[model samples]
Target: MSTLPVLNNADMYHHYSDVQFRDGCSVIHEMLKPKRGESILDLGCGTGRLTMQLASLVGDSGRVVGVDPDSCRIAVANEQLKKMDDIPVTFQLGSIREALPLGPFDGIFSNYVFHWFERAERAEMMHQMYDSLKPGGRLTFVLETNQPQPNAIIRDIFRLTEPNLDEESASGMKMDVPSVWLQHCSDAGFLVELSEVFRTEKAGPNLDAILQFLKASIPNFQPIKLTDDGLHELDSRYKTGNGDEVAFSLTVLKVLARKPQES
Candidate 1:
């Protein structure tokens, strides 16, 4: 989930995120094991779904800050925050590339986010995350691994449809391998606790639905504006007789690492 500061429709994206992604992140949360009274940062906490969950896990005494670059999603997150007065949850519009919300947090958690930062800046970003954490604080994140090759349909869509996107920008969307990311954590002086890759398939009602999900969630695709007719044509051309439903596989990497306590 790259930070789209100007999302086309935050509400629609939030809806699909809840339907497809929220449940899968439960395992990442378990790996985090946030405790009572701990202050945590939910990096790229789109619409605050998992951030709110972290608030519950950390309990009433704990504080959780959900930060994202998109003001639209942050607005949605704040709207939801009104109902959660009893919980110490806050939503902020910010980019990790700019600065994290004030923190020497006990833990930092992100989902499918780190890879979205500029490739050249990633090492510095990792170091910044490290600097924001308290001694012995943990950093846990899960992201889709870079496929050996981009999906043909998606690649074609970007290459053909997105007039504003260039070759380099499209290539930047690919995530790094698990080993490279694990090395990032190690380079940042984190004690690597876990690093593993897993696969999951996401199903949708139709190709159109899946495309909408991607358009809503992916920053690079924000420039793409397709009408109902266009989507129907897409479905007709690429659906491969899968009936009205579509499923796609994701190669995901989960990493948990901790800052060493002061000597």
Candidate 2:
């Protein structure tokens, strides 16, 4: 919520549509198989792609609330949902770390969002989520697992820009292992239901396509400060096996936990 660098609207819209949001929606839907007449909350629901899908899943008797920190993204999401009539949906501009307005939802879902918060803040956010859920309500989150290749790239970029990049540059919020996230959820009093790492590969036909993908999937790439030489270096490094495309594997951590019933 602080004055972080904002994403370019046009570029982000293109990137979101072309790369990130589609896959993210699929992952979230897979994790949350919503049923009819069930209340749902979408944490960090950028552009409302999943939120709208959730609305359809929940039907007229149910409600869906989407929350995000960026007002621009929320505005876009609202505009997208306006075309549809008579659907129960709400969008709020706020950080997930803070208290949420609506509570006791049947399910809480998020994708590619939690890694943005600091470790302690993430723990607190999990606690807030736990309190927001009804007894036996489900909480599921999909986040990037800290892997060697991505971490090396991130470190190199930060080191190139500024030798003494702080915790922000290091992305201290990202959980190094799946166990760490599961531990945090368990510590927050959630009954751990499922937790595991999933790996998938994405391919781009060219360097431009790869850059577009990164712009959408990697939030920090939005604020990149790269020298001309650095830019060229990156281009040279990311290439495909056939030497005609750019392909890379992304490692992810998927977790499903539930709020405990009181005695």
Candidate 3:
């Protein structure tokens, strides 16, 4: 996985992600409906926290394969997996954009990881996922929708600092709308089981907390290098100030689709 991209702050990513991924795990379990002895894939499994939970759900007879592009994250995940010798789970260090060999899987579940790719990479990713699944397998994932989504403080700051560039030309990965993602799944021969976009509110106590969270997120998704000046500028405009706290709301997109049985 030498060619795969990784965040410099892998430790920060692991610490910050434990909470965000925990909530997504419940949703994944509800939608994926994992059963014992089923072979499942956890796409972009990060430090393998959610993957372990999935392993527990599937039990001893089952197998869970967790894949992530970041070698740093995979190393940590392997370290953690070493202690859980009883579970039938393995961590693989590779990008989902790359070809995978261990499936014909019963199901595939990913949370908050698909928006990083550009159009062509995403096309390949969807195709690879379709190829990896069994005849009647399912895939469920949660990611932000394109446009009108929240957590744009950095984007806004970049605009203010360098006003010439447009949003499309901005240096970040693009997120697609729900319809586009559904269409991609359909094109890849998957049936749309559940598809919806909804809103959620998330907040931080102050500017420092918010910046810390963004620092953890931005590096993993895009190669943007945020500076102290950029942070100050973003905080000046984006954070809502009250007596002693600040907050914001974010729009989220969720989809759960499945591959139909081949006849």
After superposing candidate 2, which stretches have Cα over 4 Å from the reference?
Answer: 1-14, 17-19, 97-99, 149-173, 209-233, 241-244
Model 1: weakest 10-residue lDDT segment is 148-157
TM-score of each: 0.83, 0.81, 0.83
Clashing pairs in 3: none
The regions of model 3 sitting more than 4 angstroms off are 1-5, 97-99, 149-154, 157-171, 220-246
lDDT of each: 0.74, 0.70, 0.72
User: Candidate 1, TM-score vs. the true structure?
Assistant: 0.83
For candidate 2, write residues 1-263 as lDDT tens digits: 32112344533554435344656667567767788989989887777887888899999999999887677878888888888897989888775544255767989988777776666466677778888888988998887777644423444545555556653554434556778888889889998887778666666676555545445544555325667787666556656567666555667788888898877
Model 2 residue 255 lDDT score: 83
Candidate 1 C-alpha lDDT tens digits along 112-229 = 7776676677778788889989999999988877654423445545555564776437535647788888888899899999877876555666776766776787655642466656
Candidate structures ordered by TM-score, highest first: 1, 3, 2
Worst 10 residues of 2 by lDDT: 1-10
lDDT (0-100) at residue 157 of candidate 3? 46
Give per-residue lDDT, candidate 1, residue 259. Answer: 98
Each candidate: RMSD to true structure? 3.7, 3.6, 3.6
